[model samples]
Target: MKNFLLLIVLSLYLHSSFAQNLLQPELEAFYNPALRPFYFGVASGDPQPHSVVIWTKIVPENLGLQQIHWEVATDTLLQNVVQSGTGEADSSSAFTLKLVVENLEAGTHYFYRFQHEGRYSPIGRTKTAPEGEVPLLRFAVVSCANFPSGYFNAFGDLARRNDIDAVLHLGDYIYEYGSGGPRKKKKNFSRPHIPNHEILTLQDYRTRYGQYRLDPQLMEAHRLLPFIVIWDDHELANNSNVSGAQNHDPNSEGSWEQRKAIARQVYFEWLPVHDNPQRSIIRSFRYGGLAELWMLDGRLEGRSPQAKGTGDPALPSASRHMLGEKQTEWLLDGMKNSTARWKIMGNQVIFSPLNDSKVFSRDPSIRMDRWDGYPAERSEIFDFFYKNNLRNIIVVTGDVHTSWAFELTGDPLNPSKYNRKTGMGVTGAEFVTPSVSSFNFDEVVPKFVTWEAKRRFCKKKNNPHLRFLDLNHHGYMTLTLTPERAQADWFFVKTLYEVDYRFKQKGGRYIEYDGNQVKKNKKR
Candidate 1:
């Protein structure tokens, strides 16, 4: 009996050692064999006043159906369990579990966890949206975290903070690139894509996502805060549209339809978002009477193929759309009817016009992929705002990998329509958050060139309504909204080369309630 017990102990030790060795060298520190089958950790998202979605993944050693148990409680120890249930995972969903815990209290915090056999996954904390007279709300706005480009220091910094209620991820969560690409190095660290190839199939996308979730910072952030996420072009392919992506090759790789479908399937399976019946990602969250957030789907919905140049004949077509007709109507109508004091549009690209002639030599149509590409539709949205006399509208955008604050107006150049200095006639305000770790102007261009570009872009004579621009930085923004004003504070991480999490407040901008123009925040 003594010999048998010793042998059992030795076998268990070897099993743990082999499992640890299976992880990538860079991600080894984050991998915990004790969590076992539940390696991806836990995440919660799409929080409602009365419900929230909790997610997890189980990679069983054997290829078979796995019984997973989940629990939600009011205490971290999970002794005061509020909701409990069981779920089955198999190859069908890649063993990912996204379970909605319903009948939760409004404005309340909850602790949740998932279990397989006897092992328990990480405990995640999430909160439900507040209802009825919310005095304040804060969100960390972030985007563009390319895995191969750098480390997720920004996310690490965010995870250390406790002030933020939730994280608003405005897409480009992961890049579909190979290992040896141009953006494969960051300082001394060699961040490589897992598959070491351009991901194009179902398994490829899944593998990439698995690699990203293994990051300690991202996993910790998700474990602490609920995330409201939306995808941009990079999630599927570079500059993807309804039909095809610029990076996709139908002849060589596969059909665009098949690739897109697979990407969507994997996205829903992995993330904690609620998969509606129609699979339409356009959804709204009501924060009591204070604010209402509308997360838009700009990439896969109804966008026209990007124009080749300003001379492209399609640029002038009134039919060309960015948000498409149905989504436009839904958004405009929702804004018109919303009773919330603040209407926040969670956008994936720059909405205001940006004249890039002064900064770059690219054609005017080079920015056609953004709202500038679909001018007619953008104008229509502006027209609706003016016609309805909409007030307190805020557009939070990502994807540019830079920070910019714009005073939304009929036209920034037309003095008669918009007074840049006095800020007489403005439709709304837009705050563009910097990328989390993607390449900024400084990375792609020489330091001196980027300095010159920044100087030209921020010149008062050009783009007068442009209040602020930061062409060089890798960080996130904190958007704090109250009954009287909304403010965005930019925070920059010290470095992405290694595991440093120190950050500093770069700058900030704010707009008072009913004040359409953005103003520089008073220095602290």
Candidate 2:
């Protein structure tokens, strides 16, 4: 009898070990293993008073069917479970899981985990928004995470810091170009993307998302915090426009709508987001009594693309809209009605004044893809902010691949605005976070510091309320806010090609037009 019992016990133990080993494969692969119990990590988004969208992906045998189980707990160790449920992983969605967990305890941190097969995933964490008026809010505003150029030291660094309320990811979460996008070392840098070709089909899109999720640093970051994401052109094609894009070939690629849908599906499958396409990403979330975060969708409902030439003749009459009039109206309304101590817009592109003349002769191509290319619209947005008493408003942007702190003036269009000599302010503040592994300005600019100096001079000279511009370095920015002032710190990552997680030491860098300023919580 004893011998028989021991044999049964040994069999059970073996089965358990086999199940545990399943996690290792998901954790290691370049492609997403949906069965891995979130071995890639987990995240939550669109937080409300008592609920948020919980997201995790499950890999199956042949991108077929998958069963995903999720659980939420009140304690970090997941000791006392509060909520639990199961969902079928849609293969069409690349076996992604999105669980909308409601009725969570307000303003509290909760630990979560997903289970499939016999293996349990690593402990995942999330939080619910505060119920009523609360004074302080802390958010980590970040953007531009690319894969090839360097290490995600910034994300790894932020994971260790515990003071942030939520992570605001602006855009450029993934690069879509062939391995030639941007690299730290031109010769020995990137590997051919799994698709090995520009993405245009659903399969290609799914594969790209899978590759990015494999980044350990990204996984760690997702595991640690709730991410709020917005997409820029790279998610579809480079310099993407409403009708078409700079990267898509009319003859080679298929229909634009087909490509766009695939891109959106993959994005929804991979990330933790609220699944409402009709309701624009131009949504707002209030953090207790502290602030209201407005995330914008700058790509979809916009007008025509930027004018082509030095003065892309298109700029003059092309009805090309960046954040269509409706979304822009929504933003203005959010700013006007927001009563939180600080009002923040999770912007995608640069919103400050910029001039091509300030750029050096030997620098990378001056991108007309930013706000600099849309003067009329930019002016209208600024005018709205100025007209309203939107005092502590701050705009955090990504797409530019540089760190910039600008002193936004009331009138953004008035030429010869700033003195180009002093760092001052007018309306609110705008913090432009740098890229993840994108090239730093110094590496590409002819006389790096001189070019930056020219930018500073021209911005200040042409616009008075503008303050800072780095236009170099590849990393993320942390925004901390308080009842007194809102502060943002630019954090630079050491490298990106490898999955190493060491970031350079950082300091408290505040936005110039500061009130209710909050400093970076190094450990948070």
Best by TM-score: 1
Q: Which ranges of candidate 2 are over 4 A from the true structure?
A: 1-39, 62-65, 183-191, 277-280, 316-318, 360-367, 410-425, 446-459, 462-464, 497-502, 505-524
- Candidate 1 structure quality by residue, lDDT tens digits, 142-253: 9999887778999988888888888999998888887633443454678778778898877678878888998888989999999999999888998999989888988998
Which has the greatest lDDT? 1
How far residue 207's Cα lies from its native spot in candidate 1, in Å, is 0.2
Against the reference, the lDDT scores of all candidates come to 0.86, 0.69
- Can you give the lDDT of residue 8 in candidate 2? 84
Q: Ten-residue segment with the worst summed lDDT in candidate 2?
A: 19-28
Model 2 clashes, total count: 42
Q: Which tens-of-lDDT digit does each residue in 262-303 have in candidate 2?
A: 777777777888888663456788887778888888787774
Question: Can you give the lDDT of residue 59 in candidate 1?
Answer: 70
What are the RMSD figures for all models against the true structure?
A: 4.3, 6.8
TM-score of 2: 0.85
